[model samples]
Target: MRSGNPRDTDLWEWCCGFYPGSHPGECSGGTAATFDQARADFEAAWRLFLANRTEADFQAWRDHKAWTAEKYRRFDRGERMPHDWRPGQ
Candidate 1:
């Protein structure tokens, strides 16, 4: 939530000539996107391909990199579902 928009992190870094700046708004993406939005996304997908998962599932989901791509795509779409994804508390 505090890492700034993962989407826009590089943009702000490029503009500021660095990643993290002194002001919270600079790197926190506080003004960029709602914190609630980011938090919701992260919590929804933190356990994708990990919970009750086997190594084969891990490979199928993450080793080929397609799953990583899918994850970001979901983030971009703000697609959060309770049955679709649920990170541990």
Candidate 2:
């Protein structure tokens, strides 16, 4: 996601991760001077998330990502999800 704070209009904030709802897990984000930079930074963060993982950890994340994707699809279809599930913890 890309966003800007009204109080800091000159900067852009970007984030990437597996988020099932408003809650985020295993997330990385940062601020940048321009929208393009923010987007690039987010992509870099995502790459780092993959690169830093052990093989086993990556497998777990893939599983979690699949579950998260399905949960997101269900949410798009208007199904409610329980709030207690926090990924990557």
Candidate 3:
């Protein structure tokens, strides 16, 4: 996402902070030079979130959200991440 600062446009800025299931504007974090770097921060935060979760916990999270198991599977298989999932979906 582009930041208000024009210099941040080319940087791989973190879209959200360490909160799992967080979307843009829900949290905050720093930036990086590349996507891999940005994703590393996200993954680290996600791992921390998952550390306290059970299978049921994860299921519960998905139950009311746009993300689904099938979509996650596709993501795990290296498919392009789904973007159609939104509040109404």
Candidate 4:
């Protein structure tokens, strides 16, 4: 997200991680004066994140994300789910 208005932020911001599955401080993102800089920052953060985690952990996150996506697809198709079913649940 790029913003020029002073009320918001005079920089470009970007998030390179998923949510609802991400715990606090698990998301990778950053803001910079330019769009390219912001994207570079996000990429750097993502690389660091990968370096800090095991392959198994990354795979687990991928599986969870896929599951969440499938739920969303089912909902979109008008399939009925239990009342307790919710996105990311």
The predicted structure with the larger lDDT, 3 or 4, is: 4
Query: Model 2 scores what on Cα lDDT?
Result: 0.68
Displacement of the residue 16 alpha carbon in candidate 1, Å: 30
lDDT (0 to 1) per candidate: 0.40, 0.68, 0.59, 0.69
Model 1, 1-89: lDDT tens digits are 33544675532211211111123332222232565655554444434313434565444534335544566777789975334442221
- Best-to-worst order by TM-score is 4, 2, 3, 1
Estimate the overall C-alpha local distance difference test score of candidate 1.
Answer: 0.40
Higher-lDDT candidate of 1 and 4: 4
Ranking by lDDT: 4, 2, 3, 1
For TM-score, the strongest prediction is 4
For model 4, residues 6-69, the per-residue Cα lDDT tens digits are 8657467777655444465877666688778887788898887666666667666777676768
Off by over 4 Å in 3: 1-4, 8-10, 15-29, 66-89
What TM-score, to 2 decimals, does candidate 4 have? Answer: 0.58
Comparing 2 and 4 on TM-score, the stronger one:
4
Over the stretch 7-74, how does candidate 2's per-residue lDDT look in tens digits?
65646777676433223556777788888888888888889776655666656667678668768977
| Span of ten consecutive residues with least summed lDDT in model 3 | 15-24
TM-score to true structure, per model: 0.23, 0.43, 0.42, 0.58
